[model samples]
Target: MNLRQFEVFHAIMRTGTVTGAARLLNVTQPSVSTVLKHLEAQLRFRLFNRIGGRLQPTPEAQALLPDIDAVFSRLAAVQRLTQDLAGGRLGTLSVAAAFPIANGYMARAVASFLTGRPGMRMALQSLTTPQVVDRVASREVELGVVHEPVGSTEVDTELLLRSALAAVLPATHPLARLERIPLAALEDHPVITYLPQNLFRFHVDKALAEAGISPRIVAQVTVSLTGIMLARHGAGIALVEPLMLRSLDFPGLVARPLDPPVAFETVLIRPRGTPDSTVLARFVAHLRDVLRAEGLLPEGH
Candidate 1:
């Protein structure tokens, strides 16, 4: 009828004597006997019979065993989940990241975090910067990682990494010989990069404008990895954030810095008023470590 009654009943059913049930339940024999008496009173049925100084279950008790076991089994599961959550070993961690971080640094960090937290589950989504920001603001995701600035009143952003932009060139490209690719030189050849609406694309346009160079825009990509892939296939030189280049090894693509050192930044975001979760904090810490190790994040981030 009640939790303690069910506990006493279960212990008695399993151990077969009041004294044994008392020992199993870590209670006095009289306490177990009193609970059993009260339980039978509430049920209005005899649950056990005393014979030869031992207890044996009656038919009603036998019939109730299956249901009691089911209840206790579910309670055990709930208990385990509580313990796991308290210890930071369970629950789902949802992250929405822009394409570049999702494909490169964030993916590596998630893999590493899962290795240490086998009981934890993850939901990683690849989205555009604005979409990631919206997800964070709407509480659809616990964390967000994006290079483009999409700050809002509902979400707080932290600068995760500031990385220099790099030129992704095919190994056989003539400009690959140069340690630093001049922005003006790109005018002679085609360029593959982010879409015009992207913040990085705006910065690229501004840099080229400042240098008095007009590059031939051959292909516009939604993500840095796609631009890198196009460059690997010899489509054109791709201007990409150095974060992807550090984590990804493209055999046919070589990364070169810009002559004037254009820089891009990645930001970590979470809902402004939401409380910090242990799992989210742990994941953020691990991501920082991974980024720092790969030289995407500065040391001591």
Candidate 2:
């Protein structure tokens, strides 16, 4: 009827006597007898017949034993899985990030995390900044990395890195001769930019506003990689963070630091009151180490 009842029945069937089942279960013989009686009453069938002071299992009990054993086996598996989750050994972490952060830093951090702790699983999704915040708030993602600081008090934010924005242009562009070009100087040229919905676009727009310049947008794309590719093909100059340009081998693209340098901040976000599990903490440390090695973190900070 219940797990305890089934367990008692199973033990009695194996041990062939109530007293032996009691010893196996670390209980009194009377307790085993009570459970066996209750199980047979609940099932409305005789599970055993007494023969020579031993329990001889009936045909019905013999037929039910396999199913009961299977149930207990699955229950044991569930127990083990719960233990593994609690121990931070088995579970899938849902991670959400803004585009380039997902591609650039988070990708490496996740790879390093898996290398250090194999068998841990993760599901990574790339989303816009607002989407990252929404996902964290809705408990869709256990951890989120995004460019914009989440405004909701329900989300805890940790500053990850502030990468300096660079001016990426075709190698033959005339401004390429200069060490760094001012933001206003690019207004007349066709400025290939990240889409307005992207986090990088938010930072770029804010910086341009601060610089008192209105960008003449030529083409807008979703990702930094796309912007760089467009810039390399002479679509227009792109404003992007330094790291985004690092892994690309576009021969025609030259990246120069913005003269009045603008920096974009990356923040790690999570739902407030969610305790930092061992897995998430390890991932945070791995991320910092990766950024530090890349010289993306502020000097001595």
Candidate 3:
């Protein structure tokens, strides 16, 4: 009828005698007898026959043993799986991120993390800033990395890095000769930019607006990689973060710092009330170390 009764029945079937079953179960003989009687009553079928002061398993008990053993085996597997997860020995991490961090920073960080911790697995989803926030808020992802400033009270964010934005231009472009491209110089050029909905796009637009310059929008792309490709083909200059610049090896594109440089802040976000697991914390640390080693993070940060 229940797990305990099934266990008692199994013990009695294996040992044949009530006293032996009681010893196997670490229970009194009377308790074992009581459980067997209750189980037989609930099932409306006798599981064993009493003969010569011993339990002789019935045909029904023999038929049921295989099914009961299977159930116990599955339950044992489930218990082992939970124990592995709790010990941080085996698990999957679901991570979401905006374009730059997803493709640039987190990709490499995840690689290094997995290399060091082979028992762990990760699933990465690339999304826009809004999507990252939504995934984290909905509990679809365990963690997120994004460029936008997260203001949700239901999420906790930690600043990871403030990377300087670079002006990516075609190799032959005259502005490419300068050590840095001033915002004013880009006023007349068609600007191949990220989609307006993206965080970096918002930052670039605001910076240009503050500088009294409105960029001529030549093309808008959803991904930073697309923006880079467009810039390489001479579509127009693109304002992208330094990490994205490093990731691309476009032959015709050169990345130069923006004059009076605008930097975008990268933040690690998690649900407000949830504590980060050991695996997640180790992953965050790996990310910070990678960024710092690559000269993306602020000094001593």
Strongest candidate by lDDT: 1
Worst lDDT 10-window in candidate 2: 240-249
| Cα displacement (Å) at residue 116, model 2 | 4.2
Tell me the alpha-carbon RMSD of every candidate.
4.7, 7.0, 7.2
lDDT of 1: 0.86
Over 140-248, each residue of candidate 2 has an lDDT whose tens digit, in order, gives 9989988755678879998887767788998799999989899888878888877776656777888899889887888988777888988878788888665567754
Which segments of model 1 are wrong by more than 4 Å?
Answer: 1-83, 242-249
Residue pairs in candidate 1 whose N, alpha carbon or C atoms collide under 3 angstroms? none
lDDT of 1 at 184: 83
Residues 1-301, candidate 1: write the lDDT tens digits.
Answer: 8899989999999999999999998889999999998888888999999998889899999999999999999999999988878766887899989887798878999998898677999999999889999999999999999875675889988888777778998778899999998888888998888888777888888889998988888999877888888888878989877557667787877899998888877788899978778888878888999877876667766
Model 3 per-residue lDDT tens digits across residues 1-301: 7889878877887789999999998999999989888888889998888898887889999999999888778988999888766665577899999877788778988887787455788999988888899899889999998875776777889887667678888879999999989998999988877677666777788889888998798898877787788888878888866567677567777888887788777788898889988778767777889988887775577
Top TM-score model = 1
Which of the predicted structures, 1 or 3, would earn the higher lDDT when compared with the native? 1
Clashing pairs in 2: none
lDDT per prediction? 0.86, 0.82, 0.82
Reference-based TM-score of each model: 0.71, 0.65, 0.67
The TM-score that candidate 3 achieves is 0.67
